[model samples]
Target: MTAQHPSDVDLFAPPRRSGPRPTTTGREIPHDQLDQFSPPRIRAALIGHATALPGVFTGPSQVSEPASLALRLHDPRGRWEAFLYPSPDEFGHIHRTGFMHLTVPRPIIAPLIEAGWIEPHPITLRPQWPDTIVMLYAPRDEDELALATAIMDASWQQATES
Candidate 1:
């Protein structure tokens, strides 16, 4: 986690999301971001806002599969708390869905999960990795987009806790 994440991520902005959670698969290397993914236009809007944040940069993903562009920050509030794989390539990556992966604080992880916004990353299941890595569901509509961006902001702040 060399720092860098983005968007207006307010991890605790609203009450728990309602309804059933999106169908998410892939627990191993290529964690799937399936079901209710954002369209290109929505994804673009998310990318635009995320990249616009200070200290965040867009580049090839160090962790994800091919053709995945990720957002990372310049530093961190703590250890390995930066970097977000927001979307994946349609042709080259397993996760065609546009959901993102990043590490957030432990305190917020439970709330996020309880709220139905995220799932624990498989990496977190291992002893070496802390329970911070999570897969945020992709936004399918305007409301979801706003919440997603807010979560992004929170991730960004955690990474760049100056």
Candidate 2:
């Protein structure tokens, strides 16, 4: 038997062409018009809404992930109202997944988890927290977008209702 180097293994096969490739119609299509509700687009919309709130500030996240962002809301009493960012995994690693983290009242966490709008933070495995629960959500579908919006609204209320 001969030893095989890792590079010698064929991990993927090139595409096999069965016929002439299909061509698009002459009508021009803009890039952004395709998948207008893609994850990045949804993220941008969320950031826009969050920043429009009173005393809310937007900044690059200190956690150092590629293309990560954060939002901070401060109340008049010199206390943090809310902190929002992308949720990280249990090992404290973040991917550019559409999941998010919102620090809000413990009360708001449970129902959202139960209703299937979000999942309990993957790190802690519980809806309540010493560290606020990270929420897992996807704004891919209409229902999901509605649920995500509701969760954001609830978080905003929890932050400002003090």
Overall lDDT per candidate, in order of appearance = 0.64, 0.41
Candidate 1 runs further than 4 Å off: 1-10, 75-77, 81-96
Question: By lDDT, who's the top model here?
Answer: 1
TM-score of each: 0.78, 0.53
- For residues 1-162, what per-residue lDDT tens digits would candidate 2 score against the true structure? 122222342212211212322221212111011212327666555556566666655555543343445544545222232433232211111124444555545565555544444444443433333344444344553334444544555555555664
What is candidate 1's TM-score against the reference? 0.78
Q: What is candidate 2's TM-score against the reference? A: 0.53
lDDT (tens digit, per residue) of candidate 1 on 19-66: 788876657676776577778877777788778778767666666865
* Model 2 stretches astray by more than 4 angstroms: 1-38, 63-66, 76-95, 122-131
